[model samples]
Target: MKIKEAILGFMREQAYKPMDMQELSKIFDINKEEYKTFKKAIKSMEKEGVIVRNRNDKFGLPERMGLVSGKLQVHSRGYGFLIPDEEERQDVFIPSSFMNGAMNGDKVIAKVLKEDVKGKKCEGEIIRIIDRANKTILGVYEDSKNFGFVVAEDKRIQYDIFIPRQKKGDAKTGDMVIVEITQWPEKKRNPEGEIVDILGKKGEKGIDILAIIKKFALPEEFPDKVEKFAANIEEEISKGEYKRRVDLRDVRMVTIDGEDAKDLDDAVSIERLPNGKYKLGVHIADVTHYVRENNPLDKEALKRATSVYLIDRVIPMLPRKLSNGICSLNPKVDRLTLSCIMTIDGSGKVVDHEIVESVIKTSERMTYTDVTKILRDNDEELIKKYDYLVDDFKAMEELFEILNHKRLQRGAIDFNFEESKIILDELGKPVDIKPYERAVANRIIEEFMLVANETVAEHMFWTKTPFVYRIHEEPNEEKLHHFREFIYNLGYVMKWSNEVHPRALQDILEKVKGKKEETVVSTLLLRSMMQAKYAPQCVGHFGLAARYYCHFTSPIRRYPDLQIHRIIKEFINGGLTEERIKNLTSIVEYSSRQSSEMERIAQEAEREVDDLKKAEYMSERIGEEYEGIISSVTSFGMFVELPNTIEGLVHISDLNGDYFIYDERHLALIGERTKMMYRLGDSVKIKVTKVDIDNREIYFRLTEEDHEDEELEIHDDIKESLKSGIYEEKVMAIETGYHDEVE
Candidate 1:
């Protein structure tokens, strides 16, 4: 066994009794020659927080030392919270003074200063730093005479990195740069670093997005060899390739996507069977055909894992030559595909299915807008334009409804929150920001892709073949308890037992449909659930309520899908040989973890870009008044989300009628004197008070009328009942979805 594991085992056997170096050395039979190595291992373990020294001057596990080991999440204000790696452990708050030398995102050992008390945060002090999260930080350089500092773009990084004059490199003041840390901060010193590379000037057209790309370490361009390989691949299928695959080029398939989407990785074709069933064909681009295993292109795609969709552009997983060229299921061009053909009955049951490698020719490239106009809106002009495919479109609509109904019946939790769509001009300045509505056409494609993915996953799973599966574990008890309390405060009761099911949450969502708090409730519920990730094991997805799930649809944009495509191709050619299976077992496991981590990085980068652009958009609208709904209420303030989906904070100090007292249980800011309250989902007018471009934050103040309105006051008896916590239980039992119903 490894030294660390051996030490842990020995400690566990000893009932976690404290052991000094000499005792451990004697117990492990360490000779004089090996004692130095043994001591080094113990020190390493201590530094990693795996073992700690107690007041008795003997080492034991952190639990025995009354310490916790977790990753530190630092706030911009310098204080941080240690999120314990243990699932059930509560986060311990670390005050700035107790941080020692640990920085943001450090994995550290902490000693509890104060135990969890009612209505108070658990406090802790960092005792040791185990690991650092980042060695390089992306920021804007501010040059001075003898030295300079780089202020991090990420606000969570509390310290500005100090760069020596000679280490500034080619970067100038106000230039966006990447700084590599040479020395960490001490008691009275900032982090010392040197400029690595200058991205570009701040406020440049594409520089803002580039800064986020650099921050996340997302590769923007493919390597020369990878690009060359992709460019040299034959665009057309050869005669030998055609003979090896099922020829379905004559099949009436159509690629449905947004107009600007170039990576059309999936296409659909549906036929009404004479037996009153539907044959749904989901054809996905077979990217593995040209990008073979262990090739440069394949390696690059594996590293990328997923494409990033920013406000103005996309950093594709594959080169444009493959992603937007050969791999894209373009119209009227012969392309290779792995198709899932399912025979579904009228009730949307997959009676029979076949997964095949085929060559296909897309009949048309249809945009969501055009398809929605033709099918949902029944626009005559669009119907005329696509006269040849109206019946097919109608058939697709029929199957979509049937499939959607089947999914809903299975207790799938669908949180249909509108995404923010920012439109930019040629210069990349935000021209408008609005909610991107999902039309019925989008749902039709989604339903098709989901069924195909599930079918493919089930097929592979039953074969006992190693593969990547999209897994969403059930929410933990603590999160569910908090969610239950939150929803209960809003006058909604969810059926709870020893275990929380998706249906319970789904049912609550149904109850709140069309209510003012629907969006807020949905967002909170989403936050409560665990993130879906690619795993080597099939742990059925909780949100989708699916026993089998995989990303088998978009191979061009997602690496997991591409990796599975390669495995499916190998299986189709022949059952996996022992040699191939052995090789694939490790590959699949590694790919699952790498892809999950990369996907998260891409998502975070995308969100950062979106937030930056949104802040810039709101900056232009400063002083403009807008009607908004209270999305969340905290002790310091309430966050209000406008109709356009731009959220801004309204500070507690701005609620001027009376001193506002925060009620945690009710999720409201209650006025001490007048008994006026501002709760989640309450409508209020707010002016864009200030926009912090650097921090990507918008600050707001309640309109004077909202503060002075006497009609918004609550009765004294109700206030007294709330203060005593007597009304909360009654409110929970009251079946009221509207916020005004409580009043």
Candidate 2:
């Protein structure tokens, strides 16, 4: 008899309330002889401690099954991994057949079907889809002669939407649209949907932006009701309201930002005391004053969680009237603000701190360019125009310098690189791409904001008040090892062990500050570091080297700041007791998730805009030759980025000048006949062979005659592996589904 039959037989005989043998037999599927065998098998099950064959012989799942959860890591192959959500357990296996259509980022409930297989692996299936992470999808409308479909933009989304021609409405063939999935066919490969909104023609500027927004499901504008509410806010500060807050109307505070900045969220004032300490005031526009919790405007802001910043525009979390008008810390305007006043000694340590609600009048409104000029050259005329800022500016400069020194001493890692700033012509075409330079004024503002954020976070943590904190967990040791090896291939060495602290990485950065491979090394270091995220748990910020850190300065653009302000107020008003804090903790976690999603969407939008600009710029330059470096390598081809920052692909077939194999360990494409090699970070010359803006793809071809050899020196192990064909085999194994089977 089989184990199933024996178990059913034992259950019928010994169970106090005998389990229905028919039901048990059907569930396990067994015959009378098999039942006798399963009855004996129960002894083995009890010995293995898998279950307690009750007096009734019926069994129930262990109580711990309820706690089983993990991150839903969906694979490109439609299968996925069950990475333990607690971050402590080793990931479990979830076969493709058991996925049940769950995608990446979804939270799921899993049950342990079996324990460790030889203590090496755990296997499970998703029993419940606790939360579906995706709601909106971006796709191009495919309208044929009589039928239509929405071809999904996301490659992982295997199913397409069958759209009726009558419901297609204005969306034509190839027009991008935001389609909401109405029904998912249980047995069919396609979902049912209708065009919710027609986004414009494909590859058009407006449609490109909308595509980016839809890709992330990020909002592009405020709803009409929210906008109307913002427009109706009282613009003037009342005396009665002013009396309720601390008065700082006479303080020589000022707002400093980019020249085009409209949403001035924060202003600062710094002065020296006779006791040899500095008094620094950080006054942020109190967004909570105008938008209360659970209100329409507040709910909208909470949903956004953060502002999306593109190269040419900003999709603000709050309406313009709130972010740029009444709540903005504009110059000469009396604005209500929540202030963090700190008395600090020369050593950059806060000696005393106080948080207050205040009404502040700005003494000056200055741009970064103007302030930098005044500080760099002491432009007497510009300084004289803002007389009240003369002393305050000097104090600000001193404080920033001191803070910077302190930050360096405390192991704060500084990763600085040239960021591309596109200069557009009148027609919105990119005319020039320049590196955005950081100035003294930028550093000054950053230092002040950092300290203020740190102060607020520390206070919140100390009080045990629930609030959203900006946290960057330590990097993975295994990933850091790979990064170390990659950097070593570039002729640089870092003394990094599995247990090395981030400060060691910081020191390595300092050593490679101005070398030829600085940019590449920095890029690898970033890839090694963990991404910063918002959470209710207080983990010290790794990059800033701060014991506490939160987003408290930019309430105008960041919803987390506004939420933090509200939490702080509640704590001060004695409303944040243990129960209230518990409730707020869940809210913080949700906000963090929303904030992360919002940022991912914003980044996609920015990348789309950049890709569109690159395509537009390169469309006219097809077949034009340009100097480039091999930026990336794959089995099929290599990607080259020109000095202009436009990346194009060199397909494997184009390298037909010689038969080549991808050398994985050496990060190169090797020719079988000529031994010619192209490695990552190797400078080369290529020509634009094709440009496809519709696909957001660019193609390049290596010149047949151009050969500039600069061998990228590598470790002997990597070199030997590449020469012995071991590296190629490994690469092929990874690319050809070998790793997937093991995973």
Best by lDDT: 1
- What lDDT tens digits, residue by residue, belong to model 1 across residues 486-552? 8876678898677777888899889999998898888778867887899999989999999999999
Roughly what TM-score does model 2 have, to 2 decimal places? 0.81
Query: How accurate locally, in lDDT, is each candidate?
Result: 0.86, 0.75
For candidate 1, report its TM-score.
0.89
With a 3 Å backbone cut-off (N, CA, C), the pairs that clash in candidate 2 are 5-35, 6-38, 6-39, 7-38, 15-56, 16-56
> Candidate 1: global Cα-lDDT?
0.86
Q: What is model 1's C-alpha RMSD?
A: 5.2
lDDT of 2 by residue, 401-469 (tens): 898888888888888866666776665677776567788999899999999999999988988777889
Query: lDDT at 350 for candidate 2?
Result: 88
How far off is residue 487 in model 1, in Å? Answer: 3.0
List residue ranges in candidate 1 displaced over 4 A.
1-71, 82-93, 106-131, 713-743
What TM-score, over all chains together, does every model reach? 0.89, 0.81
